[model samples]
Target: MTAMEQGGTGMAGARRLRQPAARPTWLPPGSIAFCLRSWAAVMLALGAAFWLQIDSPASAGVTVMILSQPLRGQILSKALYRMAGTLAGAVVAIGLVAAFGQDRIMFLGGVALWLGLCVVLGTLARDFRAYGALLAGYTVAIIGIGCIDRPEDVFTVAIFRVSAIMIGIVSIAIVNDVTGSPTAWHRLAAGLRRGAAEVGQIAHDAVNGRATPDDGAWLDLAARIMALTSQVSFARTELADSALRMTGARSAMVAMLDMISCSRAIGGVLPAGAVRPAILAAVRRRFGDGTPFADEDAARQALNDLLHAAPADAPPTPAEAYLIERTMALLSYGRWVRDGIRTLEEGRAAPRVARDVRIARQQDPVLALLNGAPVMTGFAAAALICVLGGLPGTTTTLLQVATILTLSITTFDTRAFGIGALVGVPLSTVCAMVLDTRILPYGSGLPFLALMLAPVIFAGCLLLIHPRLMPVGLNFGVFFFIVLGLDNVHNYDPTQFVDRNLHYMLSAVILFFALTLAPPSARRRRFRIASAVATTLRRQFIGRGDIASPALISRQYDRLLQARTWTGHLPRKPATLRVFDRIVSLGDLNGALARARRHLARAAAIPAVAGQVARTQAMLRALHGPDAAGRLLDQAAHLLAAAGHLPPADRETLLGAVSGLFGAARLLDRNARALRHYGILPPPEAAP
Candidate 1:
């Protein structure tokens, strides 16, 4: 059966149709279980804090809420980083207080500089590690600024904050473990299997020449796998067999990338008449047959037999030979995918896949430094307002404002997140008053409080799962509990509650105005991000690095994905899509160049082939410089065309590589000119 037919009806088809499980009223799915467990842990931490007579129990509560993510492993990992950041920030706060305690101007200036540096570092680090940098940055603001009036109490406040955070972390880890929260290993396995299936399908499509290899699906898959690495680290700490599982899952990710590269290569080389029905049948069976091939050896032998035995109506040519070579590479990568799955499923270590090629993400240091400006300016402005207003109890609220703005603005659109806070604070304030005055006043036990909280907590957890509603849910949920201020000694003062709510609302407003002033518009942000990707692509072509070919290609694809997501919200303009397509095309050509270089490493009978290969590399480097990129490309094409005319019998091996180079260079030249139209490539200086 063909791949389409194989994907059809009944019990077999049910596996492909993934529907969300029907959630019952009483029971929670795995993710919600995580949320529920986190709430319980926070409550327990609060109890411990109160029992021990900690000065600020609310700090512990906030720590637990911030560390709470859907995945247990992520929570565990983040908790560790949070503690490290807290300790580091405490040290810095103590030192800063000692150096500039008496000089208010110097102290505030030092704090601003520190916050700006952290934001810059966070922007440079793109993954989970960025969280650690951000936490460290804002922690100093939280602790140092809070202790400005009483420098002597800096040590005492730092001790209390660290101790409380530790209690919360330990509590959450214990509760999550005891409650059997879903493990990260299972998530990793699911992602690997899904990726393998996708690679298989893409391979099948490529063999039939029905593939658009540069589409977004492959980029999404790569991004998902990259995002899972932190979770995998957490899983290794929890499950003993997780180390082997991580290896296998990682191999599967790399193999999927390899399959994509090979698919494009084969698609380019395979002639219209070269691929027969038998070849397509074999590919379909290999991918969708619903049965394992027993081993890589068996799968290879079967593919070999199909290729050798299939009828070819046309005479042999260079394209047909190249097709066979790339087909072999495709089958080899497909087998790796199978072995990786087997290894993950059976808890056996798979053979090591060579990933010596490092993927380098190019970040513009200047832009990163500039991105820190808005964040720092907003923070500085908030501090200035609070110091000048000179209102009692405003210091605490101002610290909260600075903390929220610094963290949120770094990761998201400043205005949008501030707006979410603006909407969420009032809703939470009303809920807090009703629960504290109306519901909890008559009750006197922990059980009554838990019962009252269940509904609100459940609702928040439900909203957190929705993509669009998450910001609102998080802002409301976290601030709601803080506003309630549940304590051992209940103080039912309506006036105090009203006053506190007003301060919070005012603080959020101050932050909103601070962020909105001279904000980067959506159009500008999209343009900058797209330009960054283009700049990175250029660097990849010109700069010599040890990055792996597959990884390099995958990183470029991921950047383009980010750019595409941004452009989706902008006005529909063909120039954006056209520029994106050119980047995609250029990336493919670069990959082809890398592969051609590797082919030249093997001995060839014709010496002239090596010279053509070197010439192509030089042309690619010149294209990177954007100086006469089109002219250099034409020169490379001439060299390849001359090499193509060499005697076919003696230069059989070199001729295929030569033809590949000529095609890729011509495509690169066309894309470079398109990029010039958008001013991505350096424009020619106006004629003097």
Candidate 2:
């Protein structure tokens, strides 16, 4: 099934475009209880209809379906949200009718007021939570303000629509539950493992600079991963995976994004060798389960010696040691989380390794504004269409808008919900005209058509559950019912309805395009890349330290691996992905350079190696930065590259050559700095 989801706003955000893999062995004819949830839903829907004075079974069905979205938790939340929105909208609708039934001008004010409030709510909400607020605003437009002239029928129509949604929700819930369909929670956890593993695997490819399948693979997979993540994140409180994993994945994602941005500015830089071999090895070895740590005592003993290592009288001395220590801490945490899982607290408990990243508004307001343009444009179009509908009364306006928004959200496969709705509404009108006008056999056939459609309804229900394609089918189902409910059904013209819906679609598309075309407010791509560089720097400087102790080294490599995995996940604009690729390479370069620095630092400690190593380190620092470091790296690369290959130099000498940037970057941090300190900043080849 095509997994539709929220927009891909973050750098390398979720992958909505990928086709879901073949179903695992655990699927097919469901259990008996699957029917129970739907049964309950039907009861609840009927009760709601009775209490709210809703007039039709169709209205009840809509209500049931709206609330019966598989996940009991989400189902309940939606139910509450729907109820609150309906009640609130009904009150406002009643007020508008009381005030504006007398004045057309006042009705517009009411419509504007309700929508503005929904917009406000949408702005603050995250994930599915925003839907309710959006619905609240629209419901008022659909039920109250749209039918301003027909004040008396407001409650009846409103009640009816709510009832219909309830009925649909109930029917589906009972059917689903009785069939023993998998719960969202199980899917959520399963998705995390699959997503995380895939993240690790694909990221390893990018990190190692493997060019095949590439970002397209990740991109195809990311949307669904994210959508699943969101679903799992919000599934029952029992669910425990951080929507964002705690460790390097966060930083990796950030760096990848930054790298992408930086490359855009610089152009065509691929980090073909940026990935650490250890990362690829690790990704391949573990898949998504994470590295086996055995137990805490084992982990502690492994880290004990590494943690005690003191700074040496050499380049990268302090930095490498620090890198070693930080990595150990993270590894221990991962082991801790793993142990918790072994105990079966699964979703109910969290592992100590749960290094969930802080979802900060990493970008400023300007960036946020840029990203929001698409959604805002969608809203604007919705408003204009309402004004243009020119329906006779508020009731007609309310019903159509409800149908429109619901249908609008259905075209997720095409990545344009607004456009989808526009297309769907007309299709619905045609279906309505065809079935209600052309085919129905007077009064006797009405019930018979509904009964015959039971099978079609079942099939549509199956399709509606799909993550991606469901919206299209769901829209069709509701529209099918909506048309049957229209009183002037027999006289309806399918062509005219289609024409109106097409324009409705235009409004949605205009909004979508407007938003998509707007400049991104945040440079998430830049952060992802920068973070990647940082991870590499940390690991490379600590090079060889891990070798002295496999466990400690494995832990450190794990952190680097984690970061690399997520960096690839940051949102990817076309411009950003290229930048990200370069950053990945740069990240590898940074790691390699750090290892060089560590060698220099250690090599300098040798009795006969001191002077040469110091010189190498000094030269390297000079070449790598504006000061000494920049010059040093430049000299080494120039010297080495010119020599036709790496020269067989002393380990200390190579280390010194690479630590130059480390020194300069350190100095820059200690003092306001730039890379232009020419006097002291000389490359190995150029240094006096």
Candidate 3:
């Protein structure tokens, strides 16, 4: 009786284990809502365009697809830029058409040149601003080149195009409002708070001399922090008091950068067990909860006490002085972090202590030119082929090429964009074909059309939400409406469908080849960024770099973040790792020099301190070996001794200057070997 029962029971249990767990609702609520919102916008756009009898009802739907963002703020912000870009491009298109209407070749060349210029600008810009530049570039191709045969209708075409885009924008806005879509400010505030906590932990760990994070970890964290640059911009459009909120956000970002730099500097100079236990405990208790200090004055006093807590019997070493300096910095910046989050949450004016910070972006003219040249060359070549080939729909083919190249410049990985196009356009074509011939043919009326579109729009939105699938989803979502060939009157001809698909596929192939020929080189970019860091360090060594300010700190963070991002794209080789390390060291050195100069400026009024500071600055200009570092440390100690005679505020300021000198010497010693290898520091024999 037991053997048969046990065997049956075991088999049943196995079957139960093999069964899937209810699939756990494959799509998240947010994604599902996004998909539904996008589909509704598309429908409303198309319906309005068709009712108005616009020349390109499909464009309205395409606009909706392109503007599909999860946050209402993003959609509104992008929509504003899109409208501006379209209007600007349309005006240029009219002028180009008027000047070269009788000369098609000249007209195409003019459009290509305009496209190239826009690509360059787009490459230089960031966030939605870049999108605007790219859109303006392609809009000319859509408006001017599109009317090569019907030059007289260029104005009419521009008007219709603008009209369709307006329809799309209005449709999306209404749908978003009706749906009560999420705001960017809410998400941004949450992200800022979370980032503050993580950064606070890093600083706390560094001050307490815990296991410090590696270079890559710090870089990664910086990148994450820098990414909020775009969110801050988007969130500015979400509220009426956006200026104040953005000010706070910017302050928070700057503070976070300062905190990281201090953390890295402290970790490098302050050895384990250097800080007194009581000071360490105070630091731990302050940051333990990951919240801003309740009282700024009280916190500053507490930190100041820790700075003086070193026994009177034993004078503070260079490491101890630097620790105190960075700890004080942590307190001040930590207050800004708290104030910024509060402003963002409550939509109030940020505290007067919170300075408005702007994160700088690195612009490489060489990289921008590299990105623009291929786009221009590819567009011209495609235009030439289309013009000479004299194909029935060559204009459409050229348009596709122009659009793809212009859009590709906005992305970091042109090859991935090309691949996405290669896969997405055809998939879109196939779906469009099936929908047109099989699905739409069996159905009629607007409701039926909307029903047929729902699933495809939903699928594209679903994929768009995923990072890996975003490129493909973006191409598919935008091109599906374009390829579907929807019009005021439906045309069910298979020949036209095949011809249009072939044109788009040809353009996709061209994009793939163009990008493959001169793909953006991650290795080259990494090297270039490293070279930039070295150059900045060279300037710092010569006392020519910008003084440490919010702006300077923000720029340093940007460059380091860019290096880290590019390094991730490269193969994990020892040489690459060394370059990355060298870049970080150079950056830290530059920050040290800048901070030293700033502190020197603050305390320069004191004649004795001024003379010593001047000598230390002279030594930095010839920074070379450990001998130089040791001498610099001696000078810093002298500066610290002078600090005791000043008032409390002046004393703290002088201490910071001394600490900066100490930090600089320590970094020079630590990275001396690598600096020598990179020619940033001279070898022992070359030392003056």
TM per model? 0.81, 0.56, 0.91
Q: What are the per-residue Cα lDDT tens digits for candidate 2 across 1-688?
A: 0000111122332333244666833223541233345434444454445455555554565555455455654664566566666667667777777777777556765565556556555545545555676667667766765456567787776766565665555555555455554555555546545544454333333322333233344434434433443453345432345333323233232222222221121111123222234432332333223343566555544333332232223222323322222233234434443433332223233344334332222122332333334343444455455557764332443445433443232122234443334444455556655665566645443345545445434444554565554555555555555545533233346555454345434443453453234423234535543543444333333332121111222222323333334454556577656555444334334433444565556656665546655766554443433353344434444322222122223422332333333322333332223112312222345533
Candidate that beats the other on TM-score, 2 or 3, i.e. the better one: 3
Flag the better candidate by lDDT, 1 or 3. 3
RMSD, model 2, all Cα superposed?
12.2
- Against the true structure, candidate 2 reaches a TM-score of 0.56
Off by over 4 Å in 3: 1-26, 272-300, 350-353, 617-627, 673-688
Q: Per-residue CA lDDT of candidate 1, range 560-595, in tens?
A: 556666666567789767655555565555555555
Put down candidate 3 lDDT per residue, 1-688, tens digits, no spaces.
0000000011222232233535444386698899999999999999999999999799999999999999988998999999999999999999999999999888888998899889999988988889999999999999988898899999999999999999999999999999999998888888888778777877776666565566656666677788888888888887888888888888888888888777766665455455666555655555454455566566556556665666677656666677666766776788888888887788786563365466777778888887788888999899888878878878888888899889987677888888988988988999999998888888788899888999999999987887767789988999999999899998898887897778888888887888667788888887778787788787776667777877777777788788877888988899888777667667777777788888787787777577776776677666766576788788888887777666667777788788778767766777777776778765556545
Model 3 residue 390 distance off true place after TM-score fit, in angstroms: 2.6
**Cα-based RMSD of candidate 3:** 9.1
lDDT of 3: 0.79
